[model samples]
Target: MTNLSLQAVKKAFGPVEVLHGIDLEIAAGEFVVFVGPSGCGKSTMLRLIAGLEEITSGTLEIGGEIANSLPPAERGIAMVFQSYALYPHMTVYDNMAFGLKISGMAKPEIDQRVRRAADMLQLTPYLDRHPKKLSGGQRQRVAIGRAVTRDPKVFLFDEPLSNLDAALRVATRIEIANLKEAMPDATMVYVTHDQVEAMTLADRIVVFNDGHIEQVGTPLELYTQPANLFVARFIGSPAMNIIPFDVLKGGDRPALLIKGVSETVVSLGPDDKICAGGTGYLGIRPEHLRVARDGDMALEGAVLVSERLGELTNIHLDIGQDDPLIIKVPGMIAPRRGEKMKVTFDRENIHLFEAEGLAV
Candidate 1:
């Protein structure tokens, strides 16, 4: 097991700086995932950790040792790229044994490592099979096995499942998770744009935006108590519904008026505070909104579209806002187009963001 630390790390190309100062600590044997949109510097950070890119400033420590000057092979780290990068002509066994062979390891030791990795990855049955004979998921497993046979202290995966189809991706993801469980002492850092992957596989997730860290927390922490508007919108599927409003009364129990919805004065809980006459945003998840009962505070809107997705239905409503407010309902539902509907949410489920986009 190995721990990693990045102190004031920065990366730049020419005069263009992409990664702002980033400081993070990854514990030994912990699985940390970096997630963000494209061009967000997540991959660049991974490359820096793998010694594939030079850091313009700051320090990188691997296993309590300064590793900025170390070469990739000397860093005791193995990287699995998005592409499998397997040799087409070599069988699974030979491919896995290639690196150990080149390193002049004893024949018996090489065979033992290869067989052990193959069994761990469920690739033992296909050891003699060529890459062409393996499915996409199997080939990806072979790539992982090759890395495992090297006995690296740290493992870096750069969107390893992106190349596979949806079903194959899910299968490969499970395999990777199992591999982590089997090798509990191996430190891992994974980069992906898929939140599902980050949520399911990581012990902790680091959310990045542009070139800076947004927030770092467990999946549920990030989902439930986002640090700001960016994370609140980005972390959830279907995205949180944000409705702009003007603060009517300030203090512990502030009141807000929805910008587009007239005559609606929403009173926030005591924990929510905002200055008077300032703008604020209300964020609610689709699943949190429900059909309004009598005498409940509600926002009325006309149904724009309803998508029936097996287990649940996502109904888009036009409530005079720029974007349609979505409500997720259980089971099959086919609301009529332009049908007027009233929805309300609980006070605890509401997220209040100040004008500066910070959560109150």
Candidate 2:
């Protein structure tokens, strides 16, 4: 079935543990992406699944078989590494056929597979060209072609597009997405640091942090309803704004007090567990804040920087916080540098983080 399952999977190198008791499942044919910052163990988890690294404890199963002890080749999996790892001396055709030839596949069958894979990756024209003669995207496609020749039940991609330029990255991402469509039954696991890649390519994204999974959900779920402060800050561009504020006691409802040029108190969730007079963080995305209107909760700040990008503008505001608050205004609006302004956010869009950064 090519489904993968991990039962309390843990990995260690000598005395140091990287992945800690991770439990997950991937349905057959699902395109799952592991995403996180560098050193967050996303790649480590991918390596473990690929059998490139051993699991120090627990079990790993692929297609309903115990595969923890299986060598990578025996596990019916193929990996495309970050570095092309191609033999510069060999032509694309030879590179794609090398593994099949070594495995004693008939020349006719190897040729058939290579040609079909090349056609799928649109690398048919470059089949006779050597690695050094091909562009970055062509070389990557050749690598993918080599993997396809193996006819693996599972495919593992470790940041395959990171080495490409911006244009090539986009083109190759579309290629990978199309590849998944072409081979719907082949399970693929991709690891990347780019959230856009995770959002676009993944059926489900596993967000990793500090050697643990912070959250697992579709892109929209993670964007709209982050589980904790770490995820709220990590998933979005310019990040969600975090401002610490105090709560007032002896009120019918809780209120968040934001202090800028003026102190402003805004009402919070009626059912939240946060006690009155306690302190917590108020979280809002840059796109959520708007120019203050009459009777709106306003915080005064001066623009530190305004970045106009044709259709949208990003402004950095110094609101007496540890970090400058960023506000994103759509279309043709640039507040001048050092211009004082008042920004307000809809209460419904605000997020509350209680003590220990737990979302309320």
Candidate 3:
């Protein structure tokens, strides 16, 4: 097992800086995923770890050794890219053994490693098949098997499932997860824009935005307690609903008057910073909202659209705000357009953010 560390890592191309003082520590055998939108520098950070890009400044350590000047071949890491990058002319077994052969490994050892990786990845049955004859997933497995045969200390995957179809992506994702279980001692760093992959596959996830690290935590940690407004809006599907509000009364329990909604007192911890006459943002996830009970504080809005998606329905309501409020409820229920709908959320589900986007 190998651990990775990055201290104030910065990368720049010409006068444009891409990574801004990133500091992170990844434990041995941990699966860490980097996720962000395009041009967000997640992929650039991955390349820096792989020694494919030089760090403009700062330190990178792998297994307690400084790796800043190390070449890619000497880093003891195996990478699987989005493309399979297999030799079309070579059979699966040959493709898997090529790297070992080029490095002058003993033929017996090469055979053992190739067969072992093939068995673990379920590619043993197609060892004699060429890339042209194999399915996309199988060919990708060949690429992974080639990496596995190297037995590197760390594994890097750069959006390895992006090229496959929906079903193939799901199947390959499961295979990758199983491969991690089979090799528990191998450290892994994966980069992808898909939150589903990051949430499901990672032991911890690092969220990046605009060349800076926004937050890093386990999936549930980021989902339940985002550090700021950007993370609160980015982590969940359909995003969290944000509404502007005025602080009517600020104390241990602050009363917020949301626009077009009744005054509601929110219970906050003692350490929360809130003051009277201040304006802030109120956030609630769609799944947390429900139909209002009699005598409960509610926000009434006109139903703009109802999307009945089998297991759950997404109801969009116009609450006199810039964006419509969405409510996610179980089962199929279609409310007529322009009908008044009332919904209320629990106090515990509320998230308060100050004017500067910092969570309170």
Give one digit per residue, the lDDT tens place, for model 2 in 1-360.
499999899988899998889989999999999888789887788888888899999999999999998998788899998898898899999999999999999999999999999999999898888999988988998999899999999999999999999899999999999999999999999998777898899998888887888888888888888888998998888799988888777789977787766788887678765633388888899999999988887987999999888989999999988889999999978888899988999887888787678777
Using all chains and alpha carbons, the TM-scores for the candidates as numbered come to 0.96, 0.95, 0.94
Of candidate 3, the 10-residue stretch with the lowest lDDT total is 261-270
Which residue segments of model 3 deviate by more than 4 Å?
Answer: 250-253, 261-277
**Candidate 2, poorest ten consecutive residues by summed lDDT:** 268-277
Pull out the clashing pairs in model 2.
Answer: none
- Whole-model Cα lDDT of every candidate shown, in order: 0.91, 0.88, 0.89
Error of 1 at 148 (Å): 0.7
Tens-digit lDDT track of model 3 for 1-360: 899999999999999999999999999899999888789898888899999999999999999999999999999999889998998889999999999999999999999999999999999999998999988988888999999999999999999988888888888888999999999999999988777888999999999999998999999999999988999999987789998888766354657777773445454555655633388888899999999998877888999999999999999999888999999999999898999988989878888888888888
Q: Which candidate's lDDT is highest?
A: 1
TM-score of 3: 0.94
Best by TM-score: 1
lDDT of 2 at 19: 87
